[model samples]
Target: LAKTTQPISMDSYEGQEVNITCSHNNIATNDYITWYQQFPSQGPRFIIQGYKTKVTNEVASLFIPADRKSSTLSLPRVSLSDTAVYYCLVGDHGGDTGRRALTFGSGTRLQVQP
Candidate 1:
């Protein structure tokens, strides 16, 4: 298991871009970095993921450097609705392990102002 660290809080205005970076120095070989976004009372939604290099989706883009020790999630033109908590998780989810639950910590609280 890899331990991840991210910002505690971030402030951004509407129509601006926001980028949150996370560091995981002890990532294992089978570990995959994943990002999630959470609103006030809702569960964290999967944003993006990458084993290496870059991966993009409708919501955000994930950028991983060659060292594979860090990752960044970029949210373009963020709106007030985007204000939420962002979490960076590293692990593997699948197979007959029969365990699928997100262990969340104090994630980065992104405040989007109008």
Candidate 2:
């Protein structure tokens, strides 16, 4: 498991681009960067994922540098409704017997203020 570092909290207004960065200094080669967003009481929702380079989707974009030590989650034109906690998880979600259950560490709390 790769340890991720993220801001404990963040604030933003409506219609703004928000970026949350995560650091994984000891990330492994097979580790994949995956991000999830959590609301007040619901389960975390998958946002984006990438192994290396950049991956884009309708929701967000994941940028992983060559060294794979860190990753960035970019939200374009964020709104107040997007306020939630973003979690960065790194692990091999493949069919590895002991790797199936990855622990959920801390997550980045994002507050989109009106």
Candidate 1 lDDT by residue in tens digits, 9-32: 999999998999999999777778
What is the clash count of model 1? 0
Which segments of model 1 are wrong by more than 4 Å? 93-102
CA displacement after TM-score superposition, residue 110 of candidate 2 (Å):
0.4
What's the CA error at residue 19 for candidate 1, in Å?
Answer: 0.7
Best by lDDT: 2
Each candidate's TM vs. the true structure?
0.90, 0.93
> Largest TM-score belongs to which candidate?
2
